[model samples]
Target: MARTTTPLTNTQVKQSKPTDKRQKLSDGGGLQLWISPNGSKSWMLDYIHPITKKRLSMSFGIYPAVSLADARKKRAEAKELIANGIDPKEHREDQSRLQELTNSHTLQTVASDWFEIKKSKVAETTSKSLWRNFDKHLFPKLGHRPIDKFNPKRSSALKLSFDIGI
Candidate 1:
């Protein structure tokens, strides 16, 4: 494999003692820095389950493939989720769901599409009346207003009651 950016010197690997515990390379938290016999440094993080006390580790990917800063960020997120009694994997799923929902749409886009679909079924006279009423009354009052609003927008001269507000 190509060399990673984890900062291990070939000579330094020969001088270090080995222990069962994972070693921290820098003062930075959660980065378990290890020097191999061939002088390659690898990083890992261990997380223990609170209820079961079982230890598990998830890679943030290899050093150069996943930079130190990004690995630390991943670690922090994992820790926060764990602290909240949430599984990091589940938290990741939730984040993905939020992103998908956020990417989907605006109310206006959906409403306009529905309007187009419904418009095709109407008679010309009815359509004309709809357009006239809509443009002169409905469109002016409601078109540019917040799409989230269910209540009709009221101009000063005409006030109409609504079942709900936006």
Candidate 2:
């Protein structure tokens, strides 16, 4: 049988059958979202992790639950995470959770995330130096430890950023 592409629109997604099976939506890099016959729509992330050297596949929740705009945003965030040597899904969930995203959080946690955020923009030497410093001075003594456990001084955050060129 000749093959053709079917755009996975909300309308089309609503009409999908559980038996519809895997259907090709796009092939030139933008081929992630696909709908099953049962009308279940999911976003598939195609990226490779630098450290693991393995391809990453991620789901952006159900279609209706996660709007198209939100899905695209997640895809972008995932790509940014990959660029920074951090797994977006795991790291965000593990460290930068929404509840902890706002102010009034640990300076150390925020600082670590800041490092991850800036990993892509800085030079390799800078990035390595920052981590090396942190690992040697803080990590072995108080690193890999939870945020609240340390009660990091609030003023310390500002000092840390300036020291690391963050």
Candidate 3:
């Protein structure tokens, strides 16, 4: 027969004390509170990787900062990701990378890159005048926007803004 784990309460969690070695207090469903000998407490979730069938541990966050309730919610979210055959850690890293790419590809950054090549090909005065127009008109309204968010409707709206002196 499989042994059952009793779910932990907030009081039990709060009253836990660190020992000479690391300790894990289970809250059932693979959620555990890890207490280090140094008195640090953090939440951890144990799960089997969908593809590998190997057990893995993922850190939720620190105690107090991530309450028992919050840790349980994260555990549910991680289990959902695992059920869909996606590793939560990899998903998180991919999201971080995508956000970094999106942030780096803002309108002003792309425009500056194009302007560098244009400067080398055009006469100095023409290049300066072109950049001046971009700086004065487009940058103020759309410079910080991500390139991926642009659409035909928004593009035309921007053109209309220039036409109407907005």
Clash count, candidate 2: 6
**TM-scores of the models, in the given order?**
0.41, 0.45, 0.76
TM-score of predicted structure 2: 0.45
Number of the top-ranking candidate, with TM-score as the measure: 3
lDDT of 2: 0.64
lDDT-based ranking, best first?
3, 2, 1
Summarize candidate 3's per-residue lDDT along 119-162 as a digit string, tens digits.
99888998898789889988899899997888747597456645
- Model 1, span 1-166: residue lDDT tens: 6334454443443345545554446313444555454545565667776557677655556555665566677878888878888777556779889766654443345445655775688777765665565567655555554444443354431233123210
Residue range 39-129, candidate 2, lDDT tens digits: 6667776667668888876676776788666776777777777778887668767765655544345545656787898878989998899
Q: lDDT of all predictions, in order shown?
A: 0.56, 0.64, 0.88
User: Which candidate, 1 or 2, would have the higher lDDT against the true structure?
Assistant: 2
Q: In every candidate, how many clashes are there? A: 0, 6, 0
Location of the lowest summed lDDT over 10 successive residues in candidate 2? 22-31
Candidate 3 total steric clashes? 0
Against the true structure, candidate 3 reaches a TM-score of 0.76
Best by lDDT: 3
- Candidate 3: Cα lDDT at 51: 93
Name model 2 segments beyond 4 Å from true. Answer: 1-18, 24-31, 96-166
The model with the greater TM-score, 1 or 3, is 3
lDDT of 1 at 74: 83
